[model samples]
Target: MGLNIGTITDACQWECVNTGTITDAYQWEFVNTGTITDAYQWEFVNTGTITDACQWEFVNTGHDL
Candidate 1:
């Protein structure tokens, strides 16, 4: 049951400039043979930079097989 990105249920697109601000910082596993892969090291930003800087991740959640 491995997901390889293209099999996702939803897809979206956007734009950005500063894409390096986001980073992967953590990970974990559950008792039900499930895993958690943290993607975005920094999830918060100022309102001033929200429009100008569009840092993003190639993924969000409900993933990691």
Candidate 2:
């Protein structure tokens, strides 16, 4: 249960595709709860599971204030 990008203004591209098997893997932050300051706007690609499946990922630059 992740992927909760709560604040991202424009220049956006989000994709989280899961096709089979995903119990729990919590570690997603591209502005997950609050505050965002210049982290290339927004770009996340969680291709199911914990990490790396189809590539295109970036979920941590600096924010939560």
Candidate 3:
């Protein structure tokens, strides 16, 4: 139903190649270092935090949030 991520360390790296839908509900934070590559639809509800040090590359051609 939802995803709850308490904290993300500085060493954390994420590579997401989504072709469908990625949905997250509630609060979360993406901090320090990371990479997010979204291709299709990505949806997020509620509030969240993203630090300036985190790298996000979204190649979304469709609907995204």
Best by lDDT: 2
Instruction: Write down the RMSD of candidate 3 (Cα, Å).
Output: 13.2
Q: Which 10 consecutive residues of model 3 have the lowest summed lDDT?
A: 1-10
What ranges in model 3 sit over 4 Å off? 1-24, 35-41, 44-62
lDDT of 2 by residue, 1-54 (tens): 335444454324443445446543344333233454443333454555565433
Better of 1 and 2 by TM-score: 2
Question: How does each model score on TM-score?
Answer: 0.17, 0.21, 0.20
Error of 2 at 49 (Å): 13
Model 1 clashing residue pairs (backbone): none
Clashing residue pairs, candidate 3? none
Off by over 4 Å in 1: 1-13, 16-48, 63-65
Cα deviation of 27, candidate 1, in Å:
29
Q: Give the RMSD in angstroms, all C-alphas superposed, for model 2.
A: 10.0
Please name the candidate that would achieve the greatest TM-score relative to the true structure. 2
lDDT of each: 0.28, 0.43, 0.30
For candidate 1, report its TM-score: 0.17
The per-candidate count of clashes, in order, stands at 0, 0, 0
Superposed by TM-score, candidate 3 places the C-alpha of residue 31 at a distance from the truth, in angstroms, of: 3.1
lDDT of 3: 0.30
**How accurate locally is residue 57 in candidate 1, as Cα lDDT from 0 to 100?**
28
